[model samples]
Target: MNKEDVSFEIFPPDFVLEPYHVFRKNALANRNRTESQEVDHDMDILYQFWSHFLVRNFNAQMYNEFRSLALDDDFSTRNASTGLHRLIQFYGASLSRNSVMPDQVVRDLVDLIRDEATTRAEHVAFYLLRSAWRSGSLDPRNREKIDSVLDAHMTAELEK
Candidate 1:
């Protein structure tokens, strides 16, 4: 992402932004050699990592900007695609009967994307929740909370 475009916005060090910046990379990378790829795979992973941290810190500007970027059709599917694949699989096992992703893990991840419910990028919270539900990994105690979150998201969308 270009620093000039986001010059109006707050930013961390260049090294930090290199992996997670998404605001102004050339929308058409192949079309423009001068432009950096719109979405960086490393950036996606970093974003997902930050998403976890954002759960506690909750920076509206940063979160909103990144999430808005994530909603785009070209936000790099690998953000949601490859990220946390090995991590989750290792921690929670596969989505099969022996799957071990904790209910709270599922719940928190769902909550992670509560504001941007429809995004398919970086951590793919919706998909994670679905996989847990299908695998019977989610505990009954947190089911209502997850449902409520999704229900509220749907309601907001319908109203919009």
Candidate 2:
């Protein structure tokens, strides 16, 4: 994805504190990433933190980094699955940027899922990503452009 293709908006400075930017936000995101044990208050905080940290500052470069990390040849199934969940959660929170991801990204995600997904957790993450991205990325307004590549991975699984 190119800079011109970035659809998410740049966040305002008031939303982030310089002293605790990456460390603080990452801690929050990693903390809330789960399915069970949610109260309304916690969900609200989760939504707020997600929007504040990820959706507002989302861009092609971030997507590229995620793509590179997840598609890394030796990325473990656990990593791929967890990574895909993170991507989907980002997608769910950004209801306005449905088509931001490229087709190849979708294919890469799917290819990785099919190839590396061995655990139920991994499959669950893939299922959610597929469902959310395919349905709309939480945005019913714009059409999403996601696809999958079946069979063996195009590139050989590189040595770690």
Candidate 3:
């Protein structure tokens, strides 16, 4: 079969390629690049790429980074603290900011869980981070409160 026929066979019978239609109409669109008509197909493609990338990579990277930062004594003196604090503040100021607790809280919990799991010779960080990450979606307020409680507990422990 020809490439076009093969493609048609692969696609659902009712399927229509929207990008092909857009490409066909691009000459007309170029004549009228109005505010809404100005299509940034490149950005759309980039967004899709990153969306897939994050979906595929975020979990593994997040766990490893959290674990590494948690166990590393120098993390507090490094990017986990001040850099992350700035990120939280910037996101908090934006109206689009959905996060209620803070990234600092997340970083603190990562450190705390890492310490507990590593020093106690228990692989608790993965469990804690996984549960906390899940709770972030299910019960955000509870997640924040839990992090706060854990932070207090860790701080008190460190004070000794």
lDDT of 1: 0.44
* Per-residue error (Å), model 1, residue 25: 12
Model 2: residues >4 Å from true position, as ranges?
1-16, 19-58, 67-84, 91-100, 116-121, 133-144, 147-160
Candidate 1 structure quality by residue, lDDT tens digits, 7-102 = 644554563533333523432232233223344555455455545554445455654554444433233432333223323332233233332334
- Cα deviation at 50, candidate 2, in Å, is 9.0
lDDT string for model 2 (13-60, tens) is 355433445644564465346443332333234344443355566555
Q: Determine the backbone clash count of candidate 2.
A: 0
Per-prediction TM-score to the true structure, in the order listed: 0.34, 0.38, 0.21
Q: Rank the candidates by TM-score, best first.
A: 2, 1, 3
Of the two candidates 1 and 3, the one with more favorable lDDT, higher being better, is: 1
- Preferred candidate (TM-score higher): 1 or 3: 1
* Residue 39 lDDT, candidate 2, scale 0-100: 22
The CA root-mean-square deviation of candidate 1, after full C-alpha superposition on the true structure, stands at 12.7
Model 3 over residues 68-127: C-alpha lDDT tens digits?
Answer: 322242134332232222222322222122434334445544555555555554434335
The number of clashing residue pairs in each candidate reads: 3, 0, 0
1 against 2, candidate with superior TM-score: 2
The candidate 3 region of ten consecutive residues with least summed lDDT is 87-96
